[model samples]
Target chain A: MKLWHSFLKEMKLSARGFYFYVEILVAVIILVMILFVVPENFRSVEDEYLFYDWPEGVFEEFVLPTLMEDDLDGKIESVEVEGDDILYPAQLIESEGTRYYIFESEEAVLRLTDLDRPKIGAIIRMDEQSQPYYEYYLQGYETQRLRNVYSIFHILDFDLMEAEFESQEVRSLTDGYLELSDRENIVPAMLTFNGSMMGVFIIAAYIFLDKQSGIIKAYAITASSVWQYLMSKVLVVLVSTILSTVIIVVPIMRLQPNYGILFVLLLASGLFSSTLGLVVASFYRNMMQAFGILYFLMIGLMLPAIAYFTPSWNPAWVQWIPTYPLIQAFKETILVNGDIGYVAWVSLGFFIASGILFVFANARYKKTLVS
Target chain B: MIKVSNLYHSYNKDEHYAVKDVSFEVEEGEIFGFLGPSGAGKSTTQNIMTGLLQLQKGNVTVAGYDVKTISNKMFNQIGMSFEESNVYSKLSAKENLEFYRKLFDVETRDPMELLRLVGLHDKADIRAGEFSKGMKHRLTFARSMINNPTLWFLDEPTTGLDPAIASEIKGIIREQNKKGVTIFLTTHNMYIADELCDRVAFIVDGELLLIDSPRNLKLQYGDKLVEVEYIKEGETIKESFSTIQKEDLDKLQEVIGKYEIQTMHTKEATLEEIFIKVTGRELV
Candidate 1:
């Protein structure tokens, strides 16, 4: 009965600080930024479904003219205006039915040829009387490719990325640019990863307030042992992590909706990162110091990618750091298109180990520094 | 109920002992006061007795339990209140009381009664963080009594408060004593110690200087003489008589019979004077 009373006391403290709310906000902000914003910027143009037509009796029919059409009826992926000066529409790449008009930008030049101007008139009689331009024009109709809807289901069986493309097979739609699209999706994921680290520090620092106010000691003085105190802290952190996941992961999941594996990853990764944060919080006297260390760790986490892609193997041991497990979990679950179950368990183990270490460290703090 | 012998403790051991060879004893159901200056090892001795610290070479026993054998049950048997309030600041007074009440297995009284005793019933649900120092001390007193402990240890129990409030706290301590609780008190405030303690001990520089009941010490050291003044034949006259002297009794009889004896009373020693006489110096 007393134990129940103590738990209520703890929940009261947690509720007052709204520690869980901050994490939920983190998750919401990240998922929204990724699924809502990044996709709009990088959407493939070919995902548009449109029908084209022209006056069959015009002196000249234009080869192609694109129109603007979006899910919201705003920025069409590609639009071509034809007149005395005719503009050829650029081709698009479609992923999950979202089309991005690659708009002949510098980056597009290296990835694609000048959106092959259709050679329809090359073998025919549509003349440059059309080249005189205004009266005669060439016309053709095509719509963007349909989004590869099945890519969502194949996310866990990531070998589809390397497997041969077989268009006759229902699963083959997950191949080709679909695989690259997920990797490209990771850029904003990196940014949100930064924001989540901020969330970890913001919430983890609250433990220091508990330490200073002697509430932790009050908890310690009870039949509540060291492990229980540590667990209470871990539970708060776990909630925060979940909220962050909801804010960041859910929306992204909605866009390239994972088949529940992402949820498992979200939970497992949240637990791991939160535990790592607790370990960081254990060593510092205050939140500002904890944040400084978190900033350093965030930088170190990104260091391996430099080596992950660089020629020298980057010779950096970034993956060996404590924060590496959660970052790697994100990469494996999201970017590398790997098995979510494998990464989830690995993340859980890391979380358990770090949590145990954090508990031991806090117990030591109580024993030595608390007085 | 509590005993200590040859207790030596040092914070910076290489420099000096905070408490050196301190020895004393408190009979069961007795109030024992420890009077000393700041840094004179009063608190160090108390902490060691409470098992918050390990004694270097002394055998200290509390409530028939060896001090070294500190178990969870022992904490329930003894209650302690420090000079500096250690109650949870953020929690309401009732919540703070509730939290400490669970630290032991003993069945405690209702915290509401404690609130009433400390004169804090109205503030029971108020946050302790906003309370003044005196209010916090009152809440701490309430917390100390929650477990209904047999051995009560209060360090500077009434260091702050208006006189009425301080007296109210003393009344509560007296009430606890009536119930046969052994209170081991430590304070530099001689007046509180004198009025409250059944037997008091003075210590200086970690050494015990004296121990006795307040009344007995005052009687032993105070001048046992009565001074009187009278106006006779339009002349003012004054005389002092030894109250303890046998021959002076007749002189007092004649003076009271023939002339009005103007204000005659026994001389008295204050607790401060007794402390100074015993320790050979003023309090810090």
Candidate 2:
């Protein structure tokens, strides 16, 4: 009951401050930006095609103009061309009254022909006994567009072709030009970075006020234990962050995520952020002194934001940060049907990290109060 | 009721003690004062007794609880007013008291009633941030009594107040004592100590120099002589003689018979003078 009263008092105090309202306003603005200001996703068909070994005149005069007329301008980022070595071994033979082209890759064999100028192009992946593993056909302009661009009759196992293309493009993409188009992916990342991480500054400012007013020392002598005090703070920030996240995400992103995972991840993130605020606030006597250091720490906490906006720039080392798993877990819950086991492990890691941070923060908070 | 025996404390390990070995006891309902200048460890001693600081050595007990091992439950029976006006500045005077009132399991006094006791009933709705220094100090005093605590620790309860408010606070202190509330008062104000404290201890350089009632201290350190001033032949002459000796009585009668006396007074030492004489340090 004492804890509950303390929590209510904390909330009332926070509500009176301008910072709390500003935080809510910022969350609303982010939601508005996500809902109305951010541009809509446009599917680029050319991204699915891998062009190879087309004559220069055919690409520039016929294919380019046709693609442009089809509103597919700049749709394909890059195209591969055949060089001195043949990328795919092919056998061309004349059959009973037509011609056939057979291409073989490591995984399967593809046989194609232009007999009777077939309007539809079929891609088939066949095994050793000529058993078809997978088959897809593109009719009308899609088939013509691909044929005119690459003169390819078939792709032997689309996965094999994709693997080759990805291996070549990975290096260029790593230079920081990857643009994510899915709202599910983008919205959760924004909410995690902009919404969750901002809790640090709010919690830090609250502690600074309490310290300045000498309420913290007063609380030290009360029936409320240090753990109860710290948890009350964490709970306030956690609830506020969750509310802002739900307000911004549900109506704007239109996503139906697994609430259990989302709740766990959001709670963990809020705990980490609030405790980090406590640690920072304990170091300074007032908010002004702490503000300078908090700005610097904001840079560290916003690494996930950089990863969210420019994913290719995200480094292997960023995973070492505790928020990184939080971002990944949010992405899995919102964007993709990710592995539940992976989410569980990441959530566990977050809980453990939060526990450690809470310990250090509690010690520092007590010391600051007594001193 | 409080007791201390050979209590010592230091901020750092093996460094000079902030509070050196000191011992004193306050009987139930007695108003005990710890008087010292800044850095004399007066506040440190109060903090230890209130369980705000750990006892580094020796033993100290407050209301039957050891200072070192007292739990938060002990705080319910004791209240403290810090030297600084530590009330929540953003909260109204009433809210500040009300907030603290709910911190204990025991039923606390009405915050408005406490405010009334501090003579702040008219300003109950005003935020403490806008209050003058004296007003804040009064609110702090009121906050300490919200729990109607059996024991109160008031540090410089009227440091910044005008004489009127200070006198009012002193009245409240006396009234609390009348109700059998043991108060551990710590202050550097000799006048307040002399007025309200039943017994006062003088501390200097982390050591206790003297502990006694104000009257007792004055009696112990005051001069035992009567000073006489008289005008003789257009010249004013002054003479002092020991009142304890029979020979001095003849000299006092001779002076009175010889010249017209202008004034005569006994030299009684103030607490300030006794403090300086005993500690060889001014109570700055």
Q: Per-residue lDDT of A112-164 in model 2, one digit per residue for the tens? A: 22221242233433467645343433434454566554444343665688788
Query: Against the correct fold, how does model 1 do in TM-score?
Result: 0.67
Best-performing candidate as measured by TM-score = 2
Best by lDDT: 2
Candidate 2's residue-wise lDDT over B159-253, tens digit each? 88988888888899899989999998998989888888889999999998888999999889999889999998999998898989999989899
Give the runs in model 2 whose Cα sits over 4 Å from its true position: A42-184, A288-296, A308-316, A336-341, B229-239, B255-262
- The candidate scoring highest on DockQ is 2
Worst 10 residues of 2 chain B by lDDT: B46-55
